[model samples]
Target: MHSFESDTTPNRQEKEHPGLKLALELGPLLVFFFANLRGEWLVSKFPVLATLGGPLLVATGLFMAATVISLIVSKIVFKHLPVMPFVSGIVVVIFGGLSIWLQDETFIKMKPTIVNTLFGVTLLIGLMFGKSLLGYVFNAAFQLTPEGWQKLTLRWGLFFLFLAVLNEVVWRNFSDATWVNFKVWGTMPITIAFTLAQMPLIMKHSIEQDTSGKP
Candidate 1:
Protein backbone atom coordinates (compact mmCIF):
# COMPACT_ATOMS: atom_id res chain seq x y z
CA MET A 1 0.00 0.00 0.00
CA HIS A 2 3.05 2.28 0.05
CA SER A 3 4.06 4.46 -2.87
CA PHE A 4 7.74 4.83 -3.86
CA GLU A 5 7.67 8.29 -2.32
CA SER A 6 6.41 6.94 0.99
CA ASP A 7 8.96 4.19 0.87
CA THR A 8 11.90 6.46 0.09
CA THR A 9 11.18 9.73 1.86
CA PRO A 10 11.95 10.16 5.53
CA ASN A 11 9.03 9.92 7.92
CA ARG A 12 7.59 13.07 9.48
CA GLN A 13 9.09 12.38 12.89
CA GLU A 14 12.58 11.83 11.48
CA LYS A 15 12.48 15.12 9.62
CA GLU A 16 11.15 17.07 12.59
CA HIS A 17 13.38 15.72 15.37
CA PRO A 18 16.81 17.09 14.59
CA GLY A 19 17.56 18.08 18.17
CA LEU A 20 16.76 14.67 19.53
CA LYS A 21 18.82 13.05 16.82
CA LEU A 22 21.81 15.26 17.59
CA ALA A 23 21.55 14.42 21.26
CA LEU A 24 21.45 10.73 20.52
CA GLU A 25 24.57 11.02 18.39
CA LEU A 26 26.60 13.22 20.75
CA GLY A 27 25.39 11.75 24.01
CA PRO A 28 28.00 8.99 24.04
CA LEU A 29 30.89 11.37 23.42
CA LEU A 30 29.69 13.62 26.24
CA VAL A 31 29.43 10.62 28.51
CA PHE A 32 32.98 9.62 27.63
CA PHE A 33 34.22 13.14 28.28
CA PHE A 34 32.64 13.47 31.72
CA ALA A 35 33.49 9.94 32.72
CA ASN A 36 37.16 10.60 32.00
CA LEU A 37 37.03 13.90 33.88
CA ARG A 38 35.50 12.40 37.03
CA GLY A 39 36.78 8.88 36.72
CA GLU A 40 38.63 8.88 40.03
CA TRP A 41 35.57 10.14 41.87
CA LEU A 42 33.51 7.39 40.29
CA VAL A 43 36.06 4.80 41.32
CA SER A 44 36.02 6.12 44.87
CA LYS A 45 32.27 5.64 45.03
CA PHE A 46 32.25 2.27 43.30
CA PRO A 47 35.55 0.55 43.98
CA VAL A 48 34.47 -2.17 41.57
CA LEU A 49 35.08 0.20 38.70
CA ALA A 50 38.81 0.07 39.48
CA THR A 51 39.01 -3.34 37.85
CA LEU A 52 38.60 -1.76 34.46
CA GLY A 53 42.27 -0.60 34.73
CA GLY A 54 42.27 3.19 35.25
CA PRO A 55 40.45 6.39 34.43
CA LEU A 56 40.97 6.13 30.70
CA LEU A 57 40.03 2.49 30.61
CA VAL A 58 36.94 3.08 32.67
CA ALA A 59 36.01 5.90 30.34
CA THR A 60 36.47 3.59 27.38
CA GLY A 61 34.13 0.99 28.86
CA LEU A 62 31.49 3.58 29.66
CA PHE A 63 31.86 5.09 26.21
CA MET A 64 31.25 1.73 24.60
CA ALA A 65 28.18 1.16 26.73
CA ALA A 66 26.87 4.62 26.04
CA THR A 67 27.38 4.13 22.31
CA VAL A 68 25.39 0.90 22.37
CA ILE A 69 22.64 2.58 24.35
CA SER A 70 22.56 5.54 21.99
CA LEU A 71 22.27 3.26 18.97
CA ILE A 72 19.48 1.36 20.64
CA VAL A 73 17.63 4.57 21.46
CA SER A 74 18.10 5.83 17.92
CA LYS A 75 16.70 2.62 16.52
CA ILE A 76 13.70 2.80 18.82
CA VAL A 77 12.95 6.44 18.11
CA PHE A 78 13.74 6.59 14.40
CA LYS A 79 13.21 2.95 13.47
CA HIS A 80 16.64 2.95 11.83
CA LEU A 81 20.29 3.34 12.72
CA PRO A 82 22.05 6.38 11.34
CA VAL A 83 24.94 5.17 9.21
CA MET A 84 27.80 7.27 10.54
CA PRO A 85 27.00 6.68 14.20
CA PHE A 86 26.53 2.98 13.66
CA VAL A 87 29.88 2.70 11.94
CA SER A 88 31.57 4.79 14.61
CA GLY A 89 29.94 2.75 17.34
CA ILE A 90 31.26 -0.46 15.86
CA VAL A 91 34.81 0.91 15.83
CA VAL A 92 34.46 2.19 19.39
CA VAL A 93 33.39 -1.18 20.67
CA ILE A 94 36.21 -2.95 18.90
CA PHE A 95 38.91 -0.60 20.07
CA GLY A 96 37.41 -0.23 23.54
CA GLY A 97 37.19 -3.98 23.92
CA LEU A 98 40.80 -4.40 22.87
CA SER A 99 41.88 -1.67 25.27
CA ILE A 100 40.14 -3.27 28.20
CA TRP A 101 41.02 -6.84 27.36
CA LEU A 102 44.73 -6.28 26.96
CA GLN A 103 45.05 -3.42 29.41
CA ASP A 104 46.61 -1.40 26.64
CA GLU A 105 45.64 2.22 25.99
CA THR A 106 47.08 2.25 22.50
CA PHE A 107 44.04 0.63 20.93
CA ILE A 108 41.55 3.11 22.32
CA LYS A 109 43.88 6.00 21.53
CA MET A 110 44.01 4.97 17.89
CA LYS A 111 40.24 4.62 17.59
CA PRO A 112 39.71 8.02 16.04
CA THR A 113 42.50 7.40 13.56
CA ILE A 114 41.03 4.08 12.51
CA VAL A 115 37.45 5.26 12.25
CA ASN A 116 38.26 8.46 10.37
CA THR A 117 40.58 6.67 7.95
CA LEU A 118 37.98 4.01 7.35
CA PHE A 119 35.35 6.59 6.50
CA GLY A 120 37.70 8.67 4.42
CA VAL A 121 38.93 5.80 2.34
CA THR A 122 35.44 4.41 1.93
CA LEU A 123 34.13 7.75 0.69
CA LEU A 124 37.01 8.22 -1.70
CA ILE A 125 36.65 4.70 -3.03
CA GLY A 126 32.95 5.18 -3.52
CA LEU A 127 33.60 8.28 -5.56
CA MET A 128 36.16 6.44 -7.67
CA PHE A 129 33.40 4.02 -8.52
CA GLY A 130 31.10 6.92 -9.50
CA LYS A 131 29.06 6.78 -6.31
CA SER A 132 28.38 9.49 -3.79
CA LEU A 133 28.09 7.44 -0.65
CA LEU A 134 27.57 10.57 1.45
CA GLY A 135 24.00 10.74 0.17
CA TYR A 136 22.94 8.08 2.64
CA VAL A 137 23.95 10.35 5.50
CA PHE A 138 22.26 13.54 4.23
CA ASN A 139 19.48 12.40 1.97
CA ALA A 140 16.86 13.09 4.59
CA ALA A 141 17.83 16.71 5.08
CA PHE A 142 17.88 17.87 1.45
CA GLN A 143 18.33 16.82 -2.11
CA LEU A 144 21.42 17.82 -4.12
CA THR A 145 22.37 17.61 -7.73
CA PRO A 146 24.76 14.79 -8.66
CA GLU A 147 27.56 17.27 -9.12
CA GLY A 148 26.89 18.73 -5.69
CA TRP A 149 26.99 15.32 -4.13
CA GLN A 150 30.26 14.52 -5.85
CA LYS A 151 31.90 17.75 -4.77
CA LEU A 152 30.58 17.47 -1.22
CA THR A 153 31.66 13.87 -0.93
CA LEU A 154 35.16 14.67 -2.15
CA ARG A 155 35.51 17.49 0.36
CA TRP A 156 34.26 15.37 3.23
CA GLY A 157 36.51 12.49 2.25
CA LEU A 158 39.58 14.65 2.37
CA PHE A 159 38.45 16.32 5.57
CA PHE A 160 38.03 12.94 7.21
CA LEU A 161 41.56 11.99 6.20
CA PHE A 162 42.84 15.25 7.64
CA LEU A 163 41.09 14.41 10.90
CA ALA A 164 42.66 10.97 10.89
CA VAL A 165 46.13 12.41 10.55
CA LEU A 166 45.35 15.04 13.15
CA ASN A 167 44.20 12.39 15.58
CA GLU A 168 47.43 10.48 15.08
CA VAL A 169 49.59 13.55 15.73
CA VAL A 170 47.67 14.54 18.85
CA TRP A 171 47.40 11.17 20.56
CA ARG A 172 50.97 10.27 19.78
CA ASN A 173 52.41 13.39 21.37
CA PHE A 174 49.92 14.56 23.98
CA SER A 175 48.94 13.38 27.43
CA ASP A 176 45.83 11.29 27.92
CA ALA A 177 43.75 14.20 29.20
CA THR A 178 44.93 16.41 26.40
CA TRP A 179 44.03 13.80 23.80
CA VAL A 180 40.62 13.26 25.34
CA ASN A 181 40.04 16.99 25.46
CA PHE A 182 40.97 17.30 21.83
CA LYS A 183 38.70 14.42 20.93
CA VAL A 184 35.67 15.84 22.70
CA TRP A 185 36.15 19.59 22.34
CA GLY A 186 38.53 20.25 19.47
CA THR A 187 37.14 17.84 16.89
CA MET A 188 33.52 18.91 17.26
CA PRO A 189 34.24 22.58 16.62
CA ILE A 190 36.51 21.80 13.69
CA THR A 191 33.91 19.57 12.14
CA ILE A 192 31.16 22.11 12.71
CA ALA A 193 33.26 24.83 11.11
CA PHE A 194 34.01 22.61 8.16
CA THR A 195 30.33 21.79 7.80
CA LEU A 196 29.42 25.48 7.95
CA ALA A 197 32.00 26.20 5.28
CA GLN A 198 30.13 23.88 2.97
CA MET A 199 26.86 25.84 3.09
CA PRO A 200 27.59 27.76 -0.09
CA LEU A 201 28.00 24.57 -2.05
CA ILE A 202 24.87 23.11 -0.57
CA MET A 203 22.90 26.23 -1.37
CA LYS A 204 24.30 26.37 -4.87
CA HIS A 205 23.25 22.88 -5.91
CA SER A 206 20.22 22.20 -3.75
CA ILE A 207 17.20 20.92 -5.60
CA GLU A 208 13.91 22.52 -4.65
CA GLN A 209 11.08 20.22 -3.83
CA ASP A 210 7.44 21.25 -4.29
CA THR A 211 4.73 20.95 -1.68
CA SER A 212 3.67 17.69 -3.27
CA GLY A 213 7.25 16.43 -2.82
CA LYS A 214 8.21 16.54 -6.46
CA PRO A 215 11.57 18.07 -7.29
Candidate 2:
Protein backbone atom coordinates (compact mmCIF):
# COMPACT_ATOMS: atom_id res chain seq x y z
CA MET A 1 0.00 0.00 0.00
CA HIS A 2 1.23 3.49 -0.89
CA SER A 3 0.04 7.03 -0.49
CA PHE A 4 1.12 10.02 -2.52
CA GLU A 5 1.19 13.65 -1.62
CA SER A 6 0.61 16.36 -4.18
CA ASP A 7 3.08 19.13 -4.81
CA THR A 8 0.26 21.60 -4.51
CA THR A 9 -1.07 20.23 -1.25
CA PRO A 10 -1.13 22.78 1.50
CA ASN A 11 1.54 22.37 4.12
CA ARG A 12 0.43 21.48 7.65
CA GLN A 13 1.03 25.06 8.75
CA GLU A 14 -1.03 26.42 5.87
CA LYS A 15 -4.06 24.17 6.20
CA GLU A 16 -7.20 26.25 6.07
CA HIS A 17 -9.82 26.36 8.76
CA PRO A 18 -12.94 26.64 6.64
CA GLY A 19 -15.15 28.12 9.34
CA LEU A 20 -12.71 30.88 10.16
CA LYS A 21 -12.10 31.55 6.49
CA LEU A 22 -15.83 31.96 5.83
CA ALA A 23 -16.26 34.25 8.81
CA LEU A 24 -13.34 36.42 7.79
CA GLU A 25 -14.63 36.74 4.23
CA LEU A 26 -18.32 37.29 5.04
CA GLY A 27 -18.05 39.18 8.33
CA PRO A 28 -17.31 42.56 6.77
CA LEU A 29 -20.22 42.31 4.36
CA LEU A 30 -22.50 41.40 7.25
CA VAL A 31 -21.33 44.47 9.12
CA PHE A 32 -22.05 46.58 6.05
CA PHE A 33 -25.58 45.20 5.78
CA PHE A 34 -26.40 45.73 9.45
CA ALA A 35 -24.90 49.19 9.43
CA ASN A 36 -27.12 50.17 6.55
CA LEU A 37 -30.17 48.84 8.35
CA ARG A 38 -29.37 50.70 11.55
CA GLY A 39 -27.72 53.79 10.12
CA GLU A 40 -30.03 56.22 11.80
CA TRP A 41 -29.65 54.62 15.19
CA LEU A 42 -25.91 54.41 14.68
CA VAL A 43 -25.72 58.04 13.67
CA SER A 44 -27.58 59.05 16.79
CA LYS A 45 -25.39 56.91 19.01
CA PHE A 46 -22.10 57.81 17.39
CA PRO A 47 -21.90 61.47 16.56
CA VAL A 48 -18.69 60.96 14.58
CA LEU A 49 -20.45 58.83 11.98
CA ALA A 50 -22.71 61.75 11.05
CA THR A 51 -19.80 63.47 9.31
CA LEU A 52 -19.70 60.62 6.83
CA GLY A 53 -23.24 61.40 5.69
CA GLY A 54 -26.43 59.31 5.60
CA PRO A 55 -26.85 55.63 6.44
CA LEU A 56 -25.37 54.32 3.22
CA LEU A 57 -22.28 56.42 3.54
CA VAL A 58 -21.88 55.48 7.18
CA ALA A 59 -22.19 51.85 6.15
CA THR A 60 -19.52 52.32 3.53
CA GLY A 61 -17.10 53.72 6.09
CA LEU A 62 -17.80 50.93 8.51
CA PHE A 63 -17.57 48.42 5.71
CA MET A 64 -14.12 49.68 4.86
CA ALA A 65 -13.00 49.45 8.48
CA ALA A 66 -14.36 45.94 8.82
CA THR A 67 -12.64 44.86 5.64
CA VAL A 68 -9.29 46.06 6.95
CA ILE A 69 -9.81 44.32 10.25
CA SER A 70 -10.71 41.10 8.49
CA LEU A 71 -7.51 41.20 6.49
CA ILE A 72 -5.46 41.84 9.59
CA VAL A 73 -7.08 38.94 11.35
CA SER A 74 -6.53 36.70 8.37
CA LYS A 75 -2.86 37.58 8.38
CA ILE A 76 -2.47 36.92 12.10
CA VAL A 77 -4.47 33.70 12.26
CA PHE A 78 -3.78 32.18 8.86
CA LYS A 79 -0.13 33.25 8.59
CA HIS A 80 -0.84 34.89 5.23
CA LEU A 81 -3.53 37.01 3.63
CA PRO A 82 -5.59 35.26 0.98
CA VAL A 83 -4.99 36.54 -2.53
CA MET A 84 -8.58 37.21 -3.61
CA PRO A 85 -9.72 38.69 -0.29
CA PHE A 86 -6.64 40.91 -0.14
CA VAL A 87 -7.39 42.23 -3.61
CA SER A 88 -11.02 42.80 -2.68
CA GLY A 89 -9.99 44.62 0.50
CA ILE A 90 -7.79 47.04 -1.41
CA VAL A 91 -10.67 47.97 -3.72
CA VAL A 92 -13.04 48.29 -0.77
CA VAL A 93 -10.73 50.77 0.92
CA ILE A 94 -10.23 52.83 -2.21
CA PHE A 95 -13.88 53.00 -3.27
CA GLY A 96 -15.19 53.18 0.27
CA GLY A 97 -12.89 56.08 0.99
CA LEU A 98 -14.09 57.90 -2.10
CA SER A 99 -17.73 57.33 -1.12
CA ILE A 100 -17.14 58.84 2.30
CA TRP A 101 -14.87 61.71 1.23
CA LEU A 102 -17.01 62.93 -1.65
CA GLN A 103 -20.34 61.91 -0.12
CA ASP A 104 -21.14 59.90 -3.22
CA GLU A 105 -22.65 56.47 -2.74
CA THR A 106 -22.09 55.53 -6.33
CA PHE A 107 -18.40 54.92 -5.72
CA ILE A 108 -19.08 52.38 -3.01
CA LYS A 109 -21.83 50.81 -5.07
CA MET A 110 -19.38 50.32 -7.89
CA LYS A 111 -16.86 48.54 -5.69
CA PRO A 112 -18.18 45.08 -6.50
CA THR A 113 -18.25 45.77 -10.20
CA ILE A 114 -14.67 46.89 -10.08
CA VAL A 115 -13.46 43.99 -7.95
CA ASN A 116 -15.24 41.35 -10.01
CA THR A 117 -14.08 42.84 -13.27
CA LEU A 118 -10.52 42.96 -11.99
CA PHE A 119 -10.61 39.31 -11.06
CA GLY A 120 -12.23 38.35 -14.34
CA VAL A 121 -9.67 40.16 -16.38
CA THR A 122 -6.71 38.92 -14.36
CA LEU A 123 -7.82 35.29 -14.62
CA LEU A 124 -8.46 35.51 -18.35
CA ILE A 125 -5.10 37.14 -18.92
CA GLY A 126 -3.35 34.52 -16.81
CA LEU A 127 -4.93 31.84 -18.99
CA MET A 128 -3.58 33.48 -22.10
CA PHE A 129 -0.10 33.12 -20.61
CA GLY A 130 -0.75 29.44 -19.76
CA LYS A 131 -0.91 30.07 -16.05
CA SER A 132 -3.87 28.86 -14.00
CA LEU A 133 -4.05 31.44 -11.27
CA LEU A 134 -7.19 29.93 -9.82
CA GLY A 135 -5.16 26.93 -8.70
CA TYR A 136 -3.14 29.12 -6.37
CA VAL A 137 -6.30 30.27 -4.69
CA PHE A 138 -7.94 26.83 -4.42
CA ASN A 139 -5.10 24.35 -4.37
CA ALA A 140 -5.33 23.81 -0.65
CA ALA A 141 -8.55 21.85 -0.97
CA PHE A 142 -7.82 19.90 -4.15
CA GLN A 143 -5.20 19.37 -6.81
CA LEU A 144 -6.03 19.39 -10.49
CA THR A 145 -4.22 18.54 -13.70
CA PRO A 146 -3.03 21.34 -15.98
CA GLU A 147 -6.04 20.98 -18.21
CA GLY A 148 -8.36 20.89 -15.23
CA TRP A 149 -6.90 24.13 -13.89
CA GLN A 150 -7.26 25.75 -17.29
CA LYS A 151 -10.90 24.78 -17.59
CA LEU A 152 -11.74 25.76 -14.04
CA THR A 153 -9.96 29.07 -14.38
CA LEU A 154 -11.85 29.87 -17.58
CA ARG A 155 -15.21 29.14 -16.00
CA TRP A 156 -14.44 31.23 -12.93
CA GLY A 157 -13.14 34.07 -15.06
CA LEU A 158 -16.38 34.20 -17.03
CA PHE A 159 -18.43 33.84 -13.87
CA PHE A 160 -16.77 36.86 -12.32
CA LEU A 161 -17.65 38.93 -15.40
CA PHE A 162 -21.24 37.77 -15.12
CA LEU A 163 -21.27 38.84 -11.49
CA ALA A 164 -19.87 42.24 -12.41
CA VAL A 165 -22.65 42.78 -14.96
CA LEU A 166 -25.24 41.53 -12.50
CA ASN A 167 -24.03 43.99 -9.87
CA GLU A 168 -24.31 46.86 -12.33
CA VAL A 169 -27.83 45.85 -13.26
CA VAL A 170 -29.07 45.45 -9.68
CA TRP A 171 -27.55 48.66 -8.33
CA ARG A 172 -28.63 50.69 -11.31
CA ASN A 173 -32.25 49.57 -11.24
CA PHE A 174 -32.95 48.81 -7.58
CA SER A 175 -33.22 50.62 -4.27
CA ASP A 176 -30.17 50.95 -2.09
CA ALA A 177 -31.62 48.62 0.52
CA THR A 178 -32.43 46.05 -2.18
CA TRP A 179 -28.93 46.29 -3.61
CA VAL A 180 -27.37 45.81 -0.18
CA ASN A 181 -29.58 42.80 0.49
CA PHE A 182 -28.66 41.27 -2.83
CA LYS A 183 -24.99 41.80 -2.12
CA VAL A 184 -25.22 39.80 1.07
CA TRP A 185 -27.76 37.15 0.11
CA GLY A 186 -27.96 36.91 -3.63
CA THR A 187 -24.26 36.72 -4.53
CA MET A 188 -23.39 34.21 -1.82
CA PRO A 189 -25.97 31.62 -2.87
CA ILE A 190 -25.17 31.99 -6.51
CA THR A 191 -21.46 31.50 -5.82
CA ILE A 192 -22.21 28.47 -3.68
CA ALA A 193 -24.31 26.99 -6.45
CA PHE A 194 -21.66 27.67 -9.04
CA THR A 195 -19.02 26.00 -6.88
CA LEU A 196 -21.25 22.99 -6.34
CA ALA A 197 -21.97 22.73 -10.03
CA GLN A 198 -18.27 22.31 -10.69
CA MET A 199 -18.06 19.12 -8.67
CA PRO A 200 -18.27 16.84 -11.70
CA LEU A 201 -15.27 18.47 -13.30
CA ILE A 202 -13.38 18.45 -10.05
CA MET A 203 -13.94 14.75 -9.59
CA LYS A 204 -13.14 13.92 -13.16
CA HIS A 205 -9.75 15.60 -13.13
CA SER A 206 -8.68 15.23 -9.54
CA ILE A 207 -4.94 14.56 -9.47
CA GLU A 208 -4.96 13.03 -6.02
CA GLN A 209 -6.48 9.72 -7.06
CA ASP A 210 -4.37 9.57 -10.17
CA THR A 211 -1.16 9.71 -8.15
CA SER A 212 -2.33 7.56 -5.23
CA GLY A 213 -0.88 4.30 -6.52
CA LYS A 214 2.63 5.63 -7.06
CA PRO A 215 5.33 4.01 -4.98
Please count the clashing residue pairs in each candidate, in the order shown.
Answer: 0, 0
Report the number of the highest-lDDT candidate.
1
Model 1 per-residue lDDT tens digits across residues 2-82 = 212221345666678878877887899999999899999989998988999899999999999999998888777777766
Candidate 2: Cα lDDT at 101: 90
lDDT of 2 by residue, 80-101 (tens): 6666778889999999999889
Q: What is the lDDT of residue 159 in candidate 2?
A: 100
The model with the greatest TM-score is 1
Model 1, global lDDT: 0.89
Candidate lDDT values, in order = 0.89, 0.88
TM-score: model 1 vs. ground truth: 0.88
